[model samples]
Target chain A: MASNLRSPLARVRGLGSAKDGTGHWWAQRLTALALIPLTLWFVAGVLGHVGADYAEVRAWIGHPVTAGLFLLLIGATFYHAALGVQVVIEDYVHNEWAKLASLLTVKAALLILGLAAALAVLSILFD
Target chain B: MSAQDEAASDPKARRPLSPHLQVYRPQLTSALSIFHRITGIALAVGTLLLVWWLVAAAAGPEAYAAASGFIGSWLGLFLLLGWSAALFYHLANGIRHLVWDAGYGFELPTVYASGWAVVIVTGALTLLAWIVGLVAW
Candidate 1:
């Protein structure tokens, strides 16, 4: 009687379910790795802004290198954050509808923040 | 064993248990998960601060000066302190994740020890950075 039906394990083992989790897991870590240096640079950059007036801050960020790095840091930080929070919400939210809503909300907010930061950096560079 | 006793004696015969988060101890892994959530929230809030700074800078000198002064106050300093800790904690945890990725530190003792170490090191670094910042000022 037990052998009458195909085993669920056999159906799942060779299929995509087991393997696909790794992509999301790997992506989270990959973004984490990229962020370490970028975060360090961003910290130091903020430190440099200490006591700087409007013009001084603007000039520093206006430099092409600083602007470029600022954009990179912002982009990577938000990307990493979105992935991290998505996992947390998925794990804890429990309700299916709530989890889906949270995941979408987080991603949308991340995109908006990233774009806003990018635009801010460009505004400084061009000014 | 009697039928009632037999049912009670067999752990495997029990219905599926409730989820782990509701029942588990506050172990290192759980603590780390909480930390990750907290840091994520802090980072989200801190992004608003970043936007504020940028907007002020873009607006002009007088506006920027007001914003700059506001951020330099004690309240601003306290907020910065929190932001710095979040940054460092997240950074250290990210490195820990990387180490785990290389197939190392999976032993139970090592995982717990490293988790505490990440917390300590992040705190220390954040303090040192703030100290240096003040001294430089």
Candidate 2:
């Protein structure tokens, strides 16, 4: 032990929480709360159309209200999924570089794929 | 003092972590927690399926047939079944999590009870959805 007599809090004065985890955590929950109802609605809609043909399915999904909610579902789902997976990678992946690469890959895939889905919804709405 | 000790002494060390998941014996609480993450990741991957279905719809009826055909196949049904169950489980367990987040339900009995409730709700909802799917066709 050194002869210095600095207080523990003072010794670590500048070091603090990363401060991002709280936002991530809160957002996860908020998105989750949003998903509860959205998911039920979507699932009910899907279950109702179990064996419907393309035309029938399109008719249901093409409704303005359905499309709007669908967009919200897609947005919330992807953002929530990205945050969740990022935490998983951070937790299990030991190597920093591999962790970083995988994290970026996962985020990118989700973002692009989600955008594609959103565009698909918009196309469905317009066409 | 080796490297770990040196790391311990350094305040600038970004993150020092240990194998937390491995060291603990699996308890019901912990098991439920792990399943939450596992189901979460599964649902995340399932979004690709969602994207494919939507893109197929956007592409038109022929492409949509391919997507629906694949989804209507045995393998697709199996995966959809899994995804649905995972969805239900994750949703129920996630609500439990939010309840905990709100600083309630910390009691051990309540935790275990809620875990079982989530399991029951998942099973029932999944069964109900499938029934509706099959009958509404």
Proportion of true inter-chain contacts also present in candidate 1: 0.55
Model 1: runs farther than 4 Å from truth? A1-15, A18-21, B1-23
**Candidate 2 runs further than 4 Å off:** A1-16, A19-21, B1-5, B8-25
Q: How do the predictions measure up, each by TM-score?
A: 0.80, 0.87
lDDT of 1 by residue, A10-125 (tens): 55544444555356667777777778888888778777766666668889989999998888778777877787777778666866788888889888988887787788789889
- Interface DockQ of each model: 0.57, 0.74
DockQ of candidate model 1: 0.57
lDDT of 2 by residue, A8-77 (tens): 5554443325444356777888999999999999998888788889888888778899999999999999
**Candidate 1 at A40: error in angstroms?**
0.9
Q: Could you tell me the lDDT of residue B108 within candidate 1?
A: 93
